[model samples]
Target: MTIRRILIANRGEIAVRIVRTCQRLGIVTVLAASEADLDSQAARLADQTICIGPPKSSASYLSVDAVVGAALAAKVDAIHPGYGFLSENQRLAQACSAVGIIFIGPTEAQLDAVGDKLKARSHALAAGLPVVPGGEVDSVEDARALAEKTGWPILIKAVSGGGGRGMKLVHEPDQLAATIELAMAEAHASFGDPRVYLERYVASGRHVEVQVLGDGENVIHLGTRDCSIQRRYQKLVEEAPAPNLRDGLRADMHCAAITFAKHLEYRGLGTVELLVDCERDTFYFLEMNARIQVEHPVTEAICGLDLVAEQIAVAEGKPLRLTQDDVHLTGHAIECRINAEDWTQDFRPSPGTVSRAVFPLGEGVRVDTHIQTGARVPPFYDSLLAKLIVHGTDRTQALERLRHALAQCVISGVSTNLPMHVELMQQEEFARGGVNTAYFPWFLENRATALRDQRVAKGN
Candidate 1:
């Protein structure tokens, strides 16, 4: 079905991004905002906007019935669910199908198959893809034996967990049972599911993911993104064309991702996250995100493909205009997630009015944001305020561009993580691309002096 008008079941910059894409395609955009987001940037950008429900997500974005009702009321042909909130909800996908609205994403069966980490691992391994060495143990004794087999320092992760929640790292067998029970309880609270599984943790490994676009039959890999720079499993910065890979690693990674995607006959834009163990020179499938990622612009910068536009075309039953060989990646792109949080206070959410807002802008710089001067940062949702992206000829040039952009970014009236980002880009380890999952904790501990020195230099 052709998408004449799309109802966006999201808010913030993602919603605005979708609206801009639809507008470019000469399609009307219908934005559904909650009571708190009526005056938000997305609400202002949409061709038409409606207040769906109250401030809480349970009554607004997460309410499938309310969202479908809003879409029907606006007479939209499709619904674009930007990442987060209800993006991965299988019930929402089915509900959209039931209402005869183009969901603009993968099928409900696909969502359910991959929504749970354990199930996704089973499917991926069966499809001849290398998955993390772990799976569900039906009993506590079984988990202990598996831990013994997998060795110490295993991760007990929730099957339906996202955003780093419901995860616990246990280093010894003695602590396994308690951690398992704790992880299960956390999982139950977070996702309303109590199932937990174990995985052999990869220390000093990088988090790299391949971006794939598929329309049920044709699947193509759009290069890779390095999302290793994260804290508490939430990425703070991401870059396209991951810094380094051994001989033919990129091709191998791309092939594995495509194989996995095609095996499932997936649709739309999704990312296959993998944990790359540099020490062993091997990669393991981590998880799949069945939605447009927040770091998509970085890939677009290098590949020069508008993923959101492709999503719209695929929803309209159009075959992919470009093939795998057609995707030509050029230059390096980096993105820093600007959040309304104070890094010094353990990254606690800090919401307030934006007293001053000055974004970096020039050649090779792109800022996707929903905040403006004097705008009040709502405490009801994610603290993500903006995304500062930049492109350059290579990693060095990209770092140079990121340094300039970070220096130019300014946000006042709230304690933001701008200082940490600035410190991160200036550090020698980051500059040399020597990073992995353990990098953040190391940086937070040992880089304090370097950060202070950089701050002093900048002040001078």
Candidate 2:
């Protein structure tokens, strides 16, 4: 139960992040890597490595049996499914329990409670939290009926989906049935679940979330994060202590998150996502992610906590060490997800051997990456290459530091979104902050229009 050794059932930057924490905690790390990732940075940093399967995630990272079997073979005391892959998987948690190995996350029941979008909504409502108006639809007729009640421009969402996959927007009644079928097919293909639900789309909403840790009986929130800068509903930039909130709004969000976590008697680390409708000046519960998030470093930066260490300690059944009063948030922190993608080419994935990799280093700057010169950027996995994080005394300083940091970053031999990040940091609206979820798409459209105008001016 002390977790002397941990099997890291993930790869890339997150795997490396877990390894660093395990090392600092004096815990030996065993990496459950795919054949394609055996030579990865995490594999190199880990005390030992085992090939779980081939390059495909289905045969490797996503396979509960493969991950647990590798943990058994390695004799690790626990398994850390960092962030993605099987991080939110209830079966993996149950499998760890059956094997007498600790899963550094929420319980199987908690996963079941929050894994389905509709179930999560019910729980949130039960916790006295407001939720978007919507319900599950079994057929096209059901969807149409719900859409009629929810009004036009409803969002069709998969029950078992995240990261924007299996989500569709319907702007009118004519697109209902076909959109329903298309959404169902996509949901089934992406999440192995055809079940979909509808929600009234908040036209001017900001994506915000609060980080909470619990020991099943006691819970405390670590403040809020703004993740509104996104493309296709996938966050590209995140900041801690979500900027431009009205007075008491941050405290309200934190309290709501704690209320929901206590209602579930939740344990371990989780993020309670919410949609803040700027026009209405109100917030609604979105869902709870029962695992570490990619943007966790921003919270860690401001709170001065090693979230991974705290997570492991909680898994060891240790009670909460810090009280709400003891926890202090001192500064602003920002994180940019640097991915191996050609943003100019519609964010196409770029996979190749890295010829050069350079990141900024200074006070208040942190770069979490698994890439190095000569490293292979595999096409089979998530395009994420690194997370660039920076901290400052306030939002302005953080933005300034982030701009300089983005300027210093350089990744070659594969197309990366570094250029896009640089431009985003300089955008006037982004600099002002508190942009809505639609802002990023609008930025893209505006950029395209500017490019066209530039082409015409060149011809003239």
Candidate 3:
């Protein structure tokens, strides 16, 4: 069954991105926007728009009832919950199935399996994928015991958490019990799940993930992406294919991801995130994102595939059309998330209006954005203003293109992290490629020290 119309239950750049794909596929788009996003770029681009609820996510984007109800009312053949919000939600998938509307993602069971951190780890181990040493901690005593066994500097993570909301790093034994309690409370408040787990922290870990597309029976990987440049576990820069892996490591990672996806008989687009311990020269399964990722453009640039189109086709009950051998990866691509935040002020959200937004356009450059001149930067949603992606013949060429693109980007009215991207491009370690996850924090510290030294020299 072909999907004639799709209800995009999302907003911002991702929503716009989906709309563009649907348009190209000759599928009508119905945007289920909140009151705040009534005039959003997606709303303008879509064939039709329907108000789901108020600006608050609970009443709108996060509301399964609102989303499914809008899909029912719009008479759309499917609902695409673009990444974040309810993209990985099982209830939305179930509700869509109950209503005879397709959910453009993995099955409900798959979501449940991967949504819980512990369950995902179990599945990874079953699929012969190595995982970090850790286990579930149900109580303060349980956490303390696990901490003792896992050694110092362990991570206290919420079982149902992502984006670093309910994660705590405990460096010493004295911080174990209290940190566990705090993490549990924070997890409860954030994800409505109080369950927390423990994991041994790898000090020199790099964030790498494999992009896979499966149609229930067959799975094929697009390649790998290195998202090690992050702040507080939130990725800011991503590149493909992952640079500087030990011999045979990249192929092994791709195979592991495919094996895990096949074990689940996964359908639709997913990302198998892994933590590469640079010191150990090995990788461990982190978790799976059961929806299209924000950094997917880098993969698209290298593979020349529209991931959203593939997702819709899978939802339409289509089998895998492209085999692993059919997929050819070329060149290198890098993406910098341009967010409406003040990097100097602790990355505080700067929501107001985009008075002027000018993005670079030329060979080897692409910008995916919903914001334009005079657009309102609403405070209720993610602060991402655009994604600046560049591709070239190789990593060096990609880095050069990214540097020029960053230099050409201009956005005013709301303070953005453009300056941060510009400086990051010039950093020798980053330019050299294959920096670990801790590299960003180290860069920040060095930057601060340099500023202090400059101030002292200037007699300020």
Candidate 4:
């Protein structure tokens, strides 16, 4: 079952990432893109390129039919949905299966079973994984009733959404009804499913996740990644081998993640997210991502594993080339997401032509991006411009390298969150490590206030 030709069913950095791996593995890559991305770096790097439709994602990237049709037309043997769009969509797997084309991801059943938040929760509990206290809510009234039991500051989570799209936080019991209503509406608009459930909110928890690879029966973890640095519940920065994580707690996390994967007979690469109450040394299952994560490179840099290549190997019915005993985590790696946004103005998307682009260089620094100096960042997709990853012997060295790397980066024409990332690298709390999920919002708020006060002082 050797994979020969691969069609990338997405665009941007992830597409370029997959193409790089496929090329190294001696496989031809067919890149499918909308008209807006036909000239992207990924498109130019691929062995072949297919244009599906216009700039809109629905007409191209997220259109399963269009993607599959392009793959079939290109005569590719397999399709790789890189990270977003149809990466976790079971329908895409089903579409690939119907046409006898390999989907370089999990099986449709495994995808559906784990992708459904409520069902995955029940499955995790059954598999002996520690889960946050909560239950499925059948209605707004039901959610309110659950909130009464779980206490105030509850989380309304969408059953079918990821990347923080269909989630709302209710601070008080009085806000429960409105938050539930809004969450459900946003859920439907984003995921086509309005079902939501309730969960106890961890106000100061750290976001840690385990990366695992499986071949139907056995599963092995690639250690933990800390993704607590986020904005609006969307992760912006990630680091491997979560700092200050006690060995006992990390061992338990690894064991539980593997157990859950094996219980589900999961194949290919997936991530199990957990919320750690850093002060209490306790953690609970948050959710499972049944596809490659945007932050996979952090793990790859530390573990020295090509996860994309491993995904293809597992899809081909091959056992993981490395065992638990052989697996090693060395060094500290950090990744800062560079997005096309004006961070000062509530992060409005600032997509446009990349008049100038000079990514950081030197040893231990890696940049994964589909934009070059002349590339145009399309407005129809996520705002990500590039991922700047750095690895060093220790956390201090890694932090210093990230700062230097960010300093070396240069982009123009479109406003980016570059300044924000630069400021973040200088934060005392972030440098000290073990900061919780709430840190980013607080930092942003404080930074804005400080700037305003400085402006007032100058005017006076």
Provide the overall lDDT of each model, using Cα atoms, as 2-decimal numbers.
Answer: 0.90, 0.94, 0.95, 0.91
Candidate 1, residue 23: the lDDT equals 85
Clashing pairs in 4: none
| Candidate 4, 182-254: lDDT as tens digits | 9989999998999998898888799999999999987899999999999988999999989888899999999
Candidate 2 Cα misplacement greater than 4 A, ranges: none
Pick out the ten consecutive residues of candidate 3 with the lowest summed lDDT.
137-146
Clashing pairs in 1: none
Give one digit per residue, the lDDT tens place, for model 1 in 182-276: 88999998899999888988887899999999989999999999999989899999998988787488788999999999999988899999999
Model 1 C-alpha RMSD to native: 2.8
Per-residue lDDT of model 3, residues 1-460, tens digit only: 9999999999999999999999999999999999999999999999999999999999999999999999999999999999999999999999999989999999999999999999999999999999999999778888888878888799989999999988999998888878888999999999999999999999999999999999999999999999999998899999999998875999999999999999999999999999998888899999999999999999999999999999998988999989999999999999999999999998999999998999999999999999999999999988999999999999999999999989999999999999999999999999889999899999999999999999999996
Q: After superposition, how far is residue 179 of candidate 3 from its true place, in Å?
A: 1.2
How many residue-pair clashes does candidate 1 contain? 0
Model 2 residue 317 distance off true place after TM-score fit, in angstroms = 0.4
Per-residue lDDT for 123 in model 3? Answer: 98
Could you tell me every candidate's TM-score relative to the true structure? 0.96, 0.99, 0.99, 0.98
RMSD of each: 2.8, 0.7, 0.8, 1.1
